[model samples]
Target: MTTRARASTMAVPAQRRLQSWIKQSRGYLFIAPAVIFLLVVMVYPLANVFVTSFTQIDTRERTQEYVGLDNYAALLDDSTLWNSVRNTVIFTAASVVLHLLIGGVLALLLNEQWLSAEVRNFTRGVLILPWLFSTAASALIWGLLYHPFGTLNYLLMSSGLASEPVEFLGDRALALMSLVLVNVWKTFPFYMVMILGGLQSIPVELYEVSRVDGAGRLQRFRHITLPMMRPVILAISTIDIITTFGHFDLVKLMTFGGPIRSTETIAYYVWQTGFRDVNFGYGAAISVMMVVVLSIGVLVYLRMFTAREQMYGETTTAL
Candidate 1:
């Protein structure tokens, strides 16, 4: 090969490398604005919260003084904080379980061939309406439904189910459950939509194969559908768990953590402490704690989910 030809070949490869570098740099450039926006909008505020958590600050004070662990120590001693923790846990668990179960069932129903395409689409469209509604609006509608002399109470009396009105939100016993039901109704459609997409992605051949092998409906669901849905369910449940734990709007609008703080959650507790009570330091501390707790919880849940899947798969294979 001539020296000129060799030089040209080397130059061509170098030019291609430069072009590739420019392309990669351009990709980063496209995302730079979003990254900067997030830093400005999200990271800076989070850093402020973390810093404020260690300071003694409130609406009454014009100045903030570093208080070290005072806020966290106070939080540990607070009974209401503990109560909010419990309520938050219960709310999250119930909401997630209902979201998955109801969403899964609805997805199954919609996936059925028995329903005509038009009927199925219309039903799905209706189911998504609740999710379409703003959280504030949904809260108001549910609030009316739970009113002492509202439609729900009137219906009960009309049907002779009860002689008088039921205090759905007013009574402490039913308040938490009532709020949970509303949260479930407003959010379950998201799970339904995601799971439905997962269901659609599942190959029809699996069910056909199972049927040809004389697998019953229950068997097919157990061995085929459940396994197929494991990943999708895991992802959906994780997102639901995180968001539900931090869920604020529905609880705030419906109950305001009312009836003696029976329905209080971490989100509401933080708001009440920071905004309403104006205990900025304490509220920031709680917010930080929420982040820590949620992180640990998600890790634990993922670990358990993976372990259970392994065990279940082994058992099924053995069977």
Candidate 2:
């Protein structure tokens, strides 16, 4: 090759390298703020929680004493901890299932073009009001409604459904169920919103095509709607599970784990152990266990979901 041609070829590579460097530098510059923010806000606190979970640190203890795995061992023997685990599982599963079912139904109804847009929008607004309200305020309102002489009881008695007012929150049997109902009510709107978004993204042509092919409403939903909505449903269900599992405020305000420890979820148990019982080390252990449990659940969800998604392609019909 001529000297000039060789020089031109070498220069072209250098120019490309320079462009690559500039692109990488710009990408790093854009992400640097977010990386630093997460490290400071999320990573630091999470690291602290992890470190604390291994030590004996209480209010009276001025310094953390390294206790190795003793806290974890103690957790294994703690009946209250196990009870909290059971309750947490129950609460999470029940709330998530109910939320998905109710939300899916509502989303389907709202997505129907035959329904008036004004009516759909109004219902959406009304449903979302619960989610917009402060958790503490909502809990208090629900607590009042569950009172012996409360609106719910009054309505039940007036409707001849009950001879007397039922002690909804005070009764151990009823308290957990009542809290579950309240949680389902509070979170269903979130699922509804998510599912509605998924439904809106689905093409109208797909539904019309299904109908033209002699598919009934239920068949269309089973075949077309569900397949399209799977990813969104899985995403929402995972979020619902995590949120319901870790929930504390509503339960604390409504029943405070009730007459019995029936409603005591892991989150409340952690607070009670740490702040109430002043056993910081035990509470930290509980927190660690909660994290571990949630992590496992998330892993299982991802594995199962990914496998399902692969087995049945993204748009494969459920029917």
lDDT agreement with native, every candidate: 0.91, 0.86
Model 2: lDDT to the true structure:
0.86
Tell me the lDDT of model 1 at 174: 95
Residue 316 lDDT, candidate 2, scale 0-100:
26
Largest lDDT belongs to which candidate?
1
Residue-wise C-alpha lDDT for candidate 2, range 253-314, written one tens digit per residue = 88787678989999999999888887787788888889889989988987788788888766
**Which regions of candidate 1 are displaced past 4 Å?**
1-30, 58-61, 311-319
Q: Candidate 1: global Cα-lDDT? A: 0.91
Clashing pairs in 1: none
| Each candidate: RMSD | 5.2, 4.7
Q: Show the lowest summed lDDT stretch of 10 residues, model 2.
A: 310-319
> What are the clash counts of all predictions, listed in order?
0, 0
Worst 10-residue lDDT window for candidate 1 reads: 310-319
lDDT of 1 at 126: 96
TM-score of each: 0.87, 0.89
